[model samples]
Target: MQGRSIPAPNDWAAQFWSPIVGAEAQATRETVAMYDMTALKRLEVTGPGAAAFLERLCTGKVAKSVGSVTYTLLLDHDGGIRSDITVARLARDRFQVGANGNLDLDWFSRHLPADGTVQVRDITPGTCCIGLWGPLARKVLQPLTDEDFSNEGLKYFRAKRAYIGSVPVTAMRLSYVGELGWELYTTADQGLKLWDTLWQAAKPLGGVIAGRGAFNSLRLEKGYRSFGTDMTYEHDPYEAGVGFAVKLDKDDFIGKAALQRRKSEVRRKLTCLTIDDPHSVVMGKEPVYDGGRAVGYVTSAAYGYTIGKGIAYAWLPAELAVPGTPVRIGYFDQRIEAVVAEEPLFDPTMSRLRG
Candidate 1:
């Protein structure tokens, strides 16, 4: 929202504030890059039944201490993933959910109990979010705020109330781009001030305003899945490569029984593919072939500037999902060669995120 004045084209209804996608992507990796993530949906759930209700709906352990953030999935009765969300426990009976879209709000509303023990509110219209990420993120942010921005002060997956200059904010130490930074959230009225404060601090430190184009490329390089694109209500958590987020040992959830049966019977998986030709780029929805036999289709694709290759994620047979398995992608009139590779190609150890 702060970069709204920048003259650039729109991607996913948000401005491509920076025209050079590769440079923006590089800046996010080398230094700090500010991203306008205000378009993302935000929701607040509170009342006596909030924890119990969310636990019953999400697959991960949700009833944790305040300031704890849990990445979880909302699954259908059939064990299919409906949405992947981050649930931040703000209080014993209050939570701020980073959800997919309006569909998630509708789903949560539809499942509310009639006893009036839980309440869900859409807070996106009144709030704004800015994602500041990179190795220099903490350096640029610590100087402007009195709050401790060190790794020890605010560890990963934690959230706390803090101030940036005169602007009050809720800082969540999480990054979708696999960097060390916080997703700063605040009231819409203070959005401009928050943006100005961050911009002035980061500009001299080589921080740039990144857009969704770079965000997509960076996320793919990190092997982060995008809901509604990389997966949907038709795919299970295991096949979607996010089985780690599901805690079967925890209390029963909506799809626990189905997952218990489906976990060991995974037939297909969302596989990562790297185009053999670094210059051959293909957008999403392309058909994939296993030696002339069409086996699956691409869900998402982007040129990974950091890795210097064209990356694509596709649904393939379990046997073909193995690393080094060769495949081909049908891009218009050409069949480009590709191979299955390990995920999180960039910083699989998560050193950057933990740093």
Candidate 2:
């Protein structure tokens, strides 16, 4: 998190993380399989005090029992989401934090203690990650590791040590897939080797290599919030309806007070909307209207293939967030028709996690 200049769009983020392939090929669709966020500075927190520091600073508990990949929000004293990160608990003494935005990396760096019992290091250059998703994901991955994924305890937010070739790895049941998937995390030197290894194992399952665009579509369809986009420092967990990730009952933590107060005082809330017309898509920052008055603005909008329509997340007034509320989203010259609906246009019951 050295405040390097932001990377230009379509840069070689994947190559930096997984250096097995040539830069040109890594930047392309064959090996990368998705958008390259490898440019995001990686930070490693380890040693005796890391867990205690995280428990006080982050929304989720970072203790040993919950040593799995978890979604957490870093907040200021005022309870806004400064960064939404995925915490990968590698072991009792080590953990990794993956963030979507660079600013959060700086935020975490500034807060570390000077005594050094808890240490933080930038490991972006040394780590590589690839996500295997879709229905056949687990079946495709079973051959690469010796652990039994079919074991009942290999549930979501869980992980265990495994190996591919000679390199040690941590296979975590974490993904944006809304389906059964795993994130293969290992050293940078072995990144491409692991990717090629997995590709060979996964090809027989008819697995489609996923890209950033498709990954974004799948996540947004499930109403997952993207850091710096759909969610920001201005929004609290309560309004985002991610309260499960925030354990208010736990011992004191940062932003706990503000979150408790904001629970009932939220004026506008994040909710999902579907365009009445499938052909009409509502883009972000479009004005959302009720009658002649503009009540809210669209934060994230996309065409959902599963629901077969335009779906979006908007910060609508709490009263207007009802399931049947009629709203309109504006385009350049024409306004698109839409309605407010409960988020998660697909599988509200969360059935896909079991598949």
Candidate 3:
């Protein structure tokens, strides 16, 4: 969100970005964008039972001290992820869990206890989310808000309340782009107004309106997992390279036992591979081979700007999962050679984030 002006979605914004402003237009090697996400819903769980319920339902540790947010996974009893969620602890007893898309209020309501202390609210329409990313994203956003961007405080996985052009907003200092950015959440009625204000402020910093396609490429470059694409209930956390989200040491959670049993039961693991031939593009579920024999399949593939090649995530057998292993990913009818690179194809050192 730097070095370019942010445009207010007027008749122009709705027309420019499509009826859905923040959604994806297409999914390709060069770009990964949002198509549709309303099938999933935004559900808010608050009250005394909120934290305790989330602790039992998710794969990550939700019991942070205060004002903390963490990426988590909702799993079935078998340890397979149902939906990836970002759990934000608003208070000791209140928390907000965000998912990909639609009607999740019903999804969470079905599991809540009949006890009146637990209140489930569907406030999707009342709230809106805008993401600011890119290498210069921080530079763009730093000047627009009055929050402390100090080194020791307000670091990653941290959230702070701030103002954007005088309107109240909750800025979560996180990014799917793997850069130091924030996801600004505010009221829906003022969504367009705030977007324009952010853009106006970020214009001098070179911020541009980041479409979903660009966001896709950014996340793919970071080797970040996408729900239902790279991860699903069919796959466990460990296999998807989301081991950090799962806390095996905890006493109990929905899939604790299953996760423990499958800790070492991984038949394949998530990996990053760069196309040997940049011209040859690989698509999802494309067969991956170790000299003709199928060892795995591409789960998510994209052309990364940072790496200057087609980098992707795949599920490969354990024998060929080590870093520096040679492999081939099939594209069209031909095979595109690749190497088993480390887990984050971009910013592996996390310098972009720390900066």
Best by TM-score: 1
Candidate with better TM-score, 2 vs 3: 2
**Candidate 2: segments with Cα more than 4 A from true spot:** 1-41, 151-153, 165-167
lDDT per residue, candidate 3, 1-355, as tens digits? 1122222333322223332222221111112211122223456778887877778777788878667998988888888888788888877887777776553455576778788667888767788877765555555566666777554557777887888767788777677777766677877787777777777766665445556555666688778888888888898888888888888777588888988899988888888887655456565788898998987888887556556666778888877889899898876677778998876776689876766
Give the least accurate 10-residue stretch of model 2, judged by summed lDDT: 1-10
Model 2 has an lDDT value of: 0.70
lDDT of 1: 0.91
Report per-prediction Cα RMSD to one decimal: 4.7, 8.3, 6.8
Clashing residue pairs, candidate 1?
none
Kindly state the number of residue pairs that clash in model 1.
0
- Alpha-carbon deviation at 281 in model 1, angstroms: 2.1
Ranking by lDDT: 1, 2, 3
lDDT for residue 205 in candidate 2, whole number 0-100: 53
- Which tens-of-lDDT digit does each residue in 299-344 have in candidate 1? 9887777777778999999999999999999977789899999988
Error of 1 at 148 (Å): 0.9
The lowest-lDDT stretch of 10 consecutive residues in candidate 1 is 1-10
The candidates, ranked best first by TM-score, are 1, 2, 3
